[model samples]
Target: MLNNRYEILEQLGRGGFGETFLAIDTRMPSRRKCVIKQLKPDDTTNTAPTPGWFEKRFQREAAILEELGQNNRQIPQLYDYFSEGENFFLVQEWIEGITLSQKHQQEGNLSEAQVEKILRELLPVLDYIHGRGIIHRDIKPDNIILRASDGKPVLIDFGIFKEVNNINGGNKTVPLGTPGYMASEQAAGHPVPSSDLYSLGLTAIFLLTGKTPQALTSDPNTGEILWRKDAPHRPSNLAAVIDRAVRFHPRDRFTSAQEMLTGLPGSAGREKTSVVVPPDTKILPPSRFERWFWVIFIVITGGFSFGFGHPIIKPWLDYLFPNEPTVKELPLIEPSSQINSFVLDEDGQTLVGGDEKGNIYLWEVATGKQKKTIAGQGKAILEIAISNDQQILASSSEDGTIKVWDLKTGKERITLPNQRGLIALALSSDGNTLVTGGKDTTVKLWNLSTGNLIETLPVEKEVVSLAINQDASIIVSGHSGGDISFWQKQGSNPYEPRIFPSINPWTAPSVAVSADGTTAASSSCQENIRIWKDSDWKDSPLQAGSSADICLIVISEDGKIIAGRSSDETIRLWNLNTKKEIFSYSPSSPKSFDSPRMIALSGDGRTVASNFDKKIQVWRPSF
Candidate 1:
């Protein structure tokens, strides 16, 4: 009998709920190849009740497919869902790819880079699926297919996926995912984002080690994962991340993909890589307030003469007698010296840095040599800008001043009024316009040629970071409140701002827009960096460590290379195209700190610049 407009060719595979078939759409003489999945009639052995239950399940699956029709590239487009002689069939796009499990069998262990690339491609799809409020409970290797033509991975089989919050009342009661890959919660009946991560982690392990994870048999008294005598052949970081992901308890595993990526080797330093301060360098413990009170009492009892013998008491007494507040300790590095600003020149060839000491240094990207030093202002420099033609360098200083200098002669070309409380600055690609934000709660546009203020766009909060897209048609700014505002020139009201969705609620210290304007990266005060794509923003899959707060974010021209600095004093390189980390560097013994504050990638994506110990150092890949 014809199954709707399709004629059955041969059975492909069968599962508990349904049987999949290779079929042909015969309504047209051409007979296009298609896949049809038909729900099976319930039997005595199976508790999935008869006639009514099968029809309901079939209809539910059809509805899900209908809803997912909009995302056709990631998922097969559903054609038709109907019933024929009590048998319900679903016609869909026939995917052509080898199952991940088949790929594993054909090829040995995959490289860390390959696994990372697969994860990066798969994550965006997962994000889209999860955003629609669906949980793909079964995400084993068998369900993923790698297309031969483009070599892209695709996820198939949504039969076990359940609505994010509707799993409790479902009649499909058995455990959903594969045994070893399933998180304890999924195995015990609760499935969430963490569950999917667990499965993905296990899949990575299978691809990396060429071994299937087996059940753990613990000693009767103590519970632990039982490993064979042989160690798996995988990178230590990859192994550690997977071990944590598949832990017996959900809480023991990485909670998000971001966390897993953060822990991966080269993404963030391992726990052992932390700086160990020598005992001699440790800070002296503070004395208890009670001790101070006792000393004061003793001095009063002795008519203040006893304090002469106590040198510490003498200083304290003098301060107390004077009734003046003690001097506040100045920070070792001036706030302006913090290297909070950066600029990519018109040719993207040179980089210049301005510090709070009012000192400026120019460096050639190729040799990383200091070409010139300009010392004009006495106060700290808060921001820097380079002209599109590479003719001049502009700087904003704490003395409420903005100065423009000739690039060749290092002479002050122009100086604008001091804008007290300067926070961030940006220059248009053509270097014609300069935008500066300060404590005045406004973004000011200036003509770089004349050093004259052009327009003032008032904002509600202090702007923390600023970026201009390639065309200079749109300007994106991040505020202390963790909001990102997009300003466009073509809009009916150019001065009015539109806010992007809040992906992070803490202050984002630095922001970078891709040359193509399709992506944006922001580094936050909370040690996290978020990447915004299309209209929505998602936190980078990479996790930031406690001591390594993300301080800088930079993107390459092709929008493929992304680099960021951590409080851990290291720079991380990410390949967006491959969806894996490429390299990382932790300074040697004498120079390492808790984190690096700023980072920049050259136009060619070959060289990197970062600030440490009051100096900007350049780095290149070992290869």
Candidate 2:
């Protein structure tokens, strides 16, 4: 049906706020294809003139688009915005090509070169967006479309976008963005330039890994991204750039897109134009403050009395106090404490973690000390991950988002959406792809470069644990049903039943794989740690143990050492080649020990670390 002079053709997409349809302009004889976005109304009793609050929001979006049109092709041109019944519709140009999300799904993870190519093109778009003081709060793969003819990424979807300086005065509302890709401040409803960088970093992660940022598990106490499996192979500079852009605190991320683009290999040494902060203006501190101050002054002047008319005392008091009280210098603010997570970058630098609470902490791995706890996040922190270069940090939280931060300047760079509470997260070896698992029960893959959700894998059962193989070819998921499923990269569904039998009636506590991907081991809460040989799955052996249960496990890259932790807080080391116990470590006093929650082994297989009750004990092989 044609609304006014526009002919509606096919529906493009539908979302919570509105619907997008591809249409043609009937007024023009040539019939040009265009896209129309219509806003859906909510229940409201007040029926005033003009438009309702939501309708006004749509009108604001229209105004933004119209303003953007001033810069040649900076944004899609808006043809019209009119009310049809109770719905508001907007029309604009329709560009062709699949979204970056599609590219990540089909390509698994993007290579460093490919990610750079895309980012080079994306940086300019961001520059334009930020130049106008506009922030794309909801930056995700679904919002970016790649032109099929030129492979250029075009960002779309402005329903939740915000203009930093054009806020309405009648109502104050929290800014909204996706969960996994939003910056800490943006998630807290304060939109800034760095928020966009956080989303862009997540987009890059999605491109490097076929998983979403929320799929990787984090240490609850530390708020750090825990990757005991395999680290993605990414260029140090590129990884650091993306990491810094998505730091937890806006202050931890790059201040501008140009700063992010500076780390690109070809763009290195190119200086970003500096922006000078405007001088503070001495203005009235709101009308209420002025009114309250005047009322107090008048009351004091009227109540005061002296022997005659208090002329002498009043003059003395006026001379002492003056007409206005001098503003006292604000006291220095004390920084708040923050929980931190740690990750080893490509160069082995100890990268700290950021949280939504505006806290950033450095991890001194050598001393196991948390240094420099900076107020980074603006709200409660959820998760944090470090890039290979130790220069970038990404954080997410209950605020419904993800953010990228720069470790050097402590600035936030990008923000992305993740409405579903992000629970687990993983980054590929290349640091280009990000995988996230959330309460939604689905594993979402993101293009970390573009802040897009590429592919979503639905696991009918609740996904309790997730691990990606070294080659990024297989994804292993441990469900609540006590079943461990192996998903191949080229399969219809990773959850499809395999010939492997269920080990226990309850979920396994932890799972690990050898670097070669030839051996798979699982530590079960039922007090069993089992291993399966690649060639014969049915011949898997279950390690005999009578402790309360196994809490964690780690397998060496060379398949030589296997470590397991029991709920009784005992560490058992085994020789994979001999299939026998090597040595066991138990505290001198059993009461002093607590169950180990997680374990990890060094590359040489000589060093091992087990965590329990916030303590990480390092062990070395005696032999």
Q: Cα lDDT of all candidates, in order?
A: 0.60, 0.57
Q: Tell me the tens digit of each residue's lDDT in model 1 across 9-76.
A: 89998766668898899886778888887765544344431123345445555766766755746667
Tens digits of per-residue lDDT, candidate 2, 1-623, equal 65768878899887655688999998888888888887665435323211233454456557667766546353567777788887777788777788889887777777888888888888888888776546678788888888766777877776343321122211112446665565533433345666787788878777766556555444444333332232366566676676566554444467678777876776858543333231211111222333344345434544243221232222223322322211111111122333333333321223354433557676443345555565654766655655433455676666667776666577776676755656656554334555666567777666667878877788666555555544445555666666666655544534333434456666544666654456777667674676767675443555565323766676654456777777667777777766666556676563533222455554335445554444445543422
**C-alpha TM-scores of all predictions:** 0.42, 0.41
Superposition error at 112 for model 1 (Å): 49
Off by over 4 Å in 1: 1-349, 365-368, 491-496, 500-508, 525-527, 534-548, 588-596
**Candidate 1 TM-score, C-alpha based:** 0.42
lDDT over C-alpha atoms for residue 221 of model 1: 27
List candidate 2 segments past 4 Å from native.
Answer: 45-60, 69-74, 160-172, 219-232, 270-623
